[model samples]
Target chain A: MLGIDDPLIWGVYILCILSMILCVVYGLINWNRGEEAEVQEIAEEEAWEEEEEKMQSEELGL
Target chain B: MDLMILNLVILVYLLATLYLGYRGWKATKDSEGYMVAGRKTHPYIMAMSYGATFISTSAIVGFGGTAAKFGMGLLWLTFLNIFVGIFIAFVIYGKATRKMGHNLNAMTFPELLGRRFESRFIQVASGLVIFLGMPLYASVVLIGAARFLETTLAINFDLALLVYSVIIAAYVIWGGLRGVMYTDAMQGTIMFLGMAVLLFETYSRLGGVTLAHQALTNMAPLVPADLAAMGHTGWTSMPVLGSPWWWTLVSTIVLGVGIGVLAMPQLVVRFMTVKSNRELNRGVLVGGIFILMMTGVAFAVGALSNVFFLNTRGMIATAVESNVDSIIPVYINATMPEWFIYVFMLTLLAAAMSTSSSQFHTQGTAIGRDIYETLTGQKGGRSILLTRIGVSTAVIMAVILGYYLPGNVIARGTAVFFGLCAAAFLPMYTLGLFWRRTTRAGASAGLIGGTLVTVFMYLFVHKAESAPLGIAKMVLGRDVLITQMPWPVVDPMLIALPISLVLTVLVSLITRPPPERHLDLCFRGMKKG
Candidate 1:
């Protein structure tokens, strides 16, 4: 068997592991902020659909 | 022997793929929901699915076998995948693509490009190209896993392909991307654990982890004299300076997958499912870790497979097997104790199923969503249903192709798949994102030009099997055609990419500008009703 403990191989391993953690940390932060942005953006982009909903509501007199 | 149990395990896993697809079908709603899961994908699920789809059986079977042959050199791909594939994909491609998608209210990659470029024709053509091309990829994934199954379980080829296609198609067809996302999370988990166990077991088998590499490194000079004559580098060393080995490693595998990830349509569409830059950022970390473990373990173990080979057989790494594709399967079957073989088999199944379903879904969506709507009216009778029909047709195509494909040619076919996507999709995608002047004619011409050239070259020119006057050889009319030093660039990507890019730009500029309002409507439409 080869050296699984080789410094070079292990070094690369450590770098990848740490990089993964860093990426996740960024991801978690983004998740919190993204939902709110999504809500606002979806509403704005779907204005016509929302208007249609309103029209339907008025017709139903709900 | 536990081969019966192993067969049962594979049977169960195959059933699971199909079951998930069936469950997803119930959830599939309109075309939007069918294609994009109604844009309500969970971040965790999305991340796993991305990982699952990204790390295919090709990486496991083909690349793993490659590692067994080439030593640790192939591990560089796993590293590049995480750094470039996941992180850069998220930060660079993901963020911008998501923003543009939200801005344009887009759904598919073709939609993104078509809407972005104000060219329905470009979108339709891209969709058609992906629809036609991606199945060849799915079929290869089928063949890889099937070949592995054949070796492990002694199953017939036709049965295996049928089993493989049905399961993956079920999930992707039903739940659409959502189903894929859900199953991927689970499959990715299994894949990670499976690798970790295999790596550990391989370590223990080799008399501890540290001792293994010593054995591997100790024998690197066992490089074949014939290979060395042809500039083939041995596993013990990087390669001789200015050798073909160095170039192949650098060029085709490295640059091919590395830069190629940027253009992968399946990965591209994933950008839009998430809610924001934040979601993309979140996915970035999950994806990176997943890639690291998946690729890192695979490579480390693949290099270690050499140790397995040397210990099992008294042959040099390269001499042990001429075909690198068989190395991983052979090693797994020979080395691992009987019981856990099922686990590894499951891992291979997961990898293949994950990628296959994805390939099916991409092609299906491309044909159904893009072509149907473009050819006929979008709101015409049964447009969405017609798309479903496309998905069905794509699956049938995969079954037929999978059955007929000889196992040996599967690897080369995979190369062709990536090359085709690179030729067809990459140029237009980049241009669609960046080039404002890019016209429909420009994108179409480049697509047709690059795809036809790449395909022609591969069929008539690329003689990975024989010296059949490959395009480069014919053009240069010599032993050496195009010398891309340090990068053993066999793929026409190097050639095709530049040509496609130039054509895309030149044609766009030469053509009369599209209506200014049309262009502005697309660009400015971002987040604006």
Candidate 2:
């Protein structure tokens, strides 16, 4: 295959392409799978941000 | 190429980079913004930054040269890179890391581990390791880029080093990881384009892939006698199995870098930049393709350069230049047109800068957040200020090392750092994320034990580093402590990682588990989506 005699070489070559395709397919399938969780995450992030800001102010004596 | 046109092109690229840096600086309002792009980075930016930072100039030029010498066997490294580096990394590790990092409000890799185990010692120790070990790797990259500038632009090496360092430091210091990632995305695009063109041109020049490969295969008898002894089979085949070459190729180059990437502090932090698993999923596609084009094209073109040189110069690539590092540059200069040279130069510049920016960022955070804050109990504005100072200090250290370190150091630097990171961090990092049973004592044991074993191997066992380090020779009265064939050739990561993993597990079993409340906090939302 592909003018290479070694199976190991060509196998790896094919695997590289296949692995990349797998990534693409996985990405496409899961693109919007986690949006709901992200909403809750956003709320949590905001709370954390507020706490971080208050802590920083306290530490800096602002 | 005309000097005027080259200067203009570089100026335009630098200006664009500076604009992005300014944009990042403008966006940053707090330490979170500086450290992990406020954890709201676009999937595209996160993916590209990760990919670009992972594939450095040494990877392209240095490893490409090795591919030229070693043959298509290097494609195995590419396979591992995509499958392991991107797919497994993002799908398995990235999601866990992002959620846990958020759970703990961890800003750095060390901080994440430290906070998870409730161990300031772990955080400070990891930070110290990174701050101390990373300069050698960073300096080699600095030297590689500066050498290119020195040669291509005809500037003084000292001037090139200073100017380049200052430009990178300015954005990284001011805009932080956001600036680094913004620039990395642009640089990654350039790298992708440059590599794509080079692969196309090489295939087209040599009458397509199969023919070029066949031509290379036909030149098998041209394998120099010395290389043949070390197990050079041909350009299209793996080195003879179990030969010294095979071990070095598989154990060191293929496995060392391929697996070691998982634990890179700079690369790992990118996982926390995105907001959710969705971003990581999206990033997988971009990162996979970007890495494929970058390393795949480099290795393929590298091996096939043999055919190009044979057709033109009637000699193999190594024959043209004894130093394998020069093969890619020589091939590009000889085959590619004048305009393409400018593009390729930008590609190399982007590769070097992207990696350097991330290194500087990671090193700075190591000092500021991990070491200083953990020890001094400082936080907020002061730590950020210290991080900026740390970035400056790192840049200066890299510049000094670049000037002082011998040129040969570049060849060994990346692998040394990667192997060390894998051994020292991977076991603890992996267990910490998944195993509720993991204890602080276990993690600490793995961290210290893995590091010591790796260092010992490099200083005594691994022939490549040991011989050059001369510690074994000075003390043990031998080039390597073990003059045995395969033992000396095998990489330290292969030895240390498994031991580290077992040590981590055993020690965890014996010691008390982490507190359940903290475990719940770390693992919250980790199973969702």
Write down the worst ten-residue block by lDDT for model 2 chain B.
B30-39
User: Which candidate should be chosen as best, given TM-score against the real structure?
Assistant: 2
Each prediction's whole-model lDDT (CA): 0.67, 0.82
Please compute the TM-score of chain B alone for each predicted structure, in the order given: 0.84, 0.93
Native contacts recovered by model 2: 0.67
> Each model's TM-score, in the order given?
0.81, 0.92
Q: Which stretches of candidate 1 lie over 4 Å from their true place?
A: A1-33, A38-40, A44-62, B3-42, B166-180, B207-210, B316-323, B337-339, B378-389, B403-411, B435-437, B465-489, B508-529
Q: Indicate the residue-level lDDT of B82 in model 2.
A: 96
**Highest DockQ scorer:** 2
Q: lDDT for model 1, please.
A: 0.67
Please give the distance, in angstroms, between residue B435's alpha carbon in candidate 2 and its true position after superposition. 0.8
lDDT of 2 by residue, B383-423 (tens): 77777677788888988988887653554677788888998
Query: What is the RMSD of candidate 1?
Result: 6.1
